[model samples]
Target: MSETPLDPRLDEDPYALQKHLGFRLTHWDVDYARLELPIEHFLMNRAGIPHGGIYATLLDTVMGYAGCYTGDPGHKKLALTLSLTTNFLSRPIGHVLIAEGRRVGGGASTFFAESTVSDETGEIIARGSGAFKYRKTRL
Candidate 1:
């Protein structure tokens, strides 16, 4: 469950990559974010399972958002990822993937976040941590 509903502004001007990948922002708060993706055929690898890159993408997006939340809908904080590391924990099972991220620690200019991707059954598919630098301007 999420602490807050996703802001409509997110879908109103979605990121190109997020829109193309078909993941939707599900929740956001001061130091947290969540995203969900319905598994699609195009997202699978030749072996028929969801691709590793898909997991990585979800982890990256969620972790970045965890540190960039701003309460105001008219203004947005941005972060440039400095580094990201993902660990594949287990194969996901089910039709949907859920990713949740939390900001762990940081200063004004840089921050750290950790995230997890889980299947519909709540099995963790991957875990990730990242470092990001806040952008100077708001979006």
Candidate 2:
């Protein structure tokens, strides 16, 4: 039988809350991570596309998680976003969005990662790259 993943909702950090509300980390490895978010009224902007901020948040979360996956399994690496640059490529019109993140460089203390958000049909909606500082979580 497949094992169920632990709930990230129990996390007390605000950043964790934001991530849980948008997308749950579904896949992870040493080099890649995947996440997904549902598109609802709350996620929309006045222009009717998914808000740019939502895309930014999703990208940041995925990239950070990707970095964490590269760390030792028992040591949880929490990442703080240092800088993020996003390029919105297309307007997304879907009920769900997917994000895939991959590590670009660096190691345990600092890292660079990039993520791309796309709609169900595989249209790229946004792409982002960011620098993050990784630290061990306090016991």
Candidate 3:
């Protein structure tokens, strides 16, 4: 994970909700983007673990970033998700969640991406994939 970031804004993520939830970009490259979501008490359920919705959100955000990147900060690719699927693997316990996403395949207008989310201990808690259309727009 990188300490200092080039930009916190992800082209695929233009919503204010992500920042409000304490999501931060930890790593980014030509192939992938990694994000970290804080595991605050409010994010937990009665079971004392973060809710599945939180994991799903992180996965989707990272995966969307993966497919929409053009390797240039000034020029960005925007993608709208067409389909998304997530699998909850286990219950995770930690102060934060680490998510990494990569582009799997696609073409000029559409793309596929896969994302994995893990706890602070590096235990995978969820996985997801998404198909998106690269909307010809820049943010």
TM-score of 3: 0.86
User: lDDT of all the models against the reference?
Assistant: 0.90, 0.77, 0.81
Candidate 2: residue 137 Cα off by (Å): 4.3
Rank by lDDT (best first)? 1, 3, 2
For 24-66, candidate 3 gives per-residue lDDT tens digits of 7777766588888888888888888888888888988898887
TM-score of each: 0.93, 0.80, 0.86
lDDT, residue 133, model 1: 98
Worst 10 residues of 1 by lDDT: 3-12
* Residue pairs of candidate 3 with colliding backbone atoms: none
Tens digits of per-residue lDDT for model 2 on 1-139?
A: 1224434542334456665466766666675777778887777789877889888888988898878763444456678899999999997766678888888999657999999999888889999999999865732
**Which regions of candidate 2 are displaced past 4 Å?**
1-16, 70-74, 136-139
In model 2, pairs of residues that clash are: none
Winning model by TM-score = 1
Please give the TM-score that candidate 2 achieves against the real structure.
0.80
In terms of lDDT, the poorest run of 10 residues in model 3 is 6-15
